[model samples]
Target: MSAALPHAPARALNNLVTQGWNQLARVYNSPVLQRVAYQPPQDEIIEQLRIAGIRRIADVGCGTGILASRIQQELAPDLIYGCDASVGMLRQAQARSDQVRWINRQAENLGLDDGAVDAVVSTHAFHFFDHAPALTEFHRILSPGGLLAIVLNNPRSRFARLLQPTMVQGLAYFPPPDEMRTLVEAAGFRITEQRPVRRPIPDQLVPDILTVARRG
Candidate 1:
């Protein structure tokens, strides 16, 4: 049986997202897309984990496992699980890393054990998820005191803010930083750090929002 009318919107949104990403899976990490898509601050993520002493990382919405590969190389986490909804993306990810566990899974329904991941990281992908269910899953899989860091496109950005609707076919949204912090808190997290990346206001800035929280 399908979901009721109230839940239908979310279901439709998920379907659209899945379809859109699946179609783009092959070219998602291509040079053309890379120039257009805003990327998370990889060096910053590594530095933060170094400071926090985090291991056993889970990279949600890990498109082609690019960031996951970096983490495996830099931090060499004991367990790095990379999950994405697109099968094509997962196939490419598997081709890249034999160490990282590449799973074909959605954000809201991660196939991971409870308290399995020490830190959950979603980079430039949270805006594409069903917030409530995905956040709940993040809370569920993370250990007590585990960190949650999400990177998203800054809605204030000239490019992302204005051109997202034309670029992506599905229901896409970039919430304000404050609203995001509240959502994470509602999912049983305590906000630790929330800041803007590529700040100092660059001329052609790909502004991003990074929010770090802890499960308590």
Candidate 2:
């Protein structure tokens, strides 16, 4: 089991994550930053969604609506919604497209009906989430057999370890692969896929983790 973070440090981390993401809302979608951030496993995720006959999907932690917009165009889902905790981020997303239903909300408290979506995709933002609660919320919001795909920084990587201090300083966290899987499974998901991919950061390459599961 993972060691629990101290209350003070945990709160500090949450604050930093909230502030940093809100601050990054302005530059998040820039081509430079996009290249640095981990990209989602789009092909695999799309294939899974297609196989499951998904009609409605939500992008939690949908920054600037980039992934949500792409899913809208590519998958052509009937309803594509985007939610984020930061108003600044939501503003950017809302500005990008009118087709997506943009909601300013936390991952743990998504103001949506139970089983309202067929799938939920979150990219490069898991480190900032309150894992247990967010996963529970994901399970609650998803239809039976609904999919959950998360793309996050891989803390197991050498590069990521070197970057941990900075991230921790910012009040974010990168959970180990096993820990993340456990949390998801404990939240009532059945893991289907988990792996890592190398993504280019500004000055170096960093590993990104991908995990896909189904609400069971």
The most accurate candidate by lDDT is 1
The residue-by-residue lDDT of candidate 1 on 151-181, one tens digit each, is: 8877766766575773466577777788898
Model 1 C-alpha lDDT versus the unseen true structure: 0.78
Q: List the residue pairs that clash in candidate 2.
A: 13-171
lDDT of 2 at 20: 71
State each model's C-alpha RMSD to the native. Answer: 5.7, 7.0
Which residue ranges in model 2 land beyond 4 Å of their true spot?
1-15, 40-44, 198-204
Q: Rate residue 115 of model 1 by lDDT.
A: 95
- For residues 19-80, what per-residue lDDT tens digits would candidate 2 score against the true structure? 67768888777776665553434544666677877889998888778888777878788999
Q: Candidate 1, after superposition: displacement of residue 172 in Å?
A: 1.4
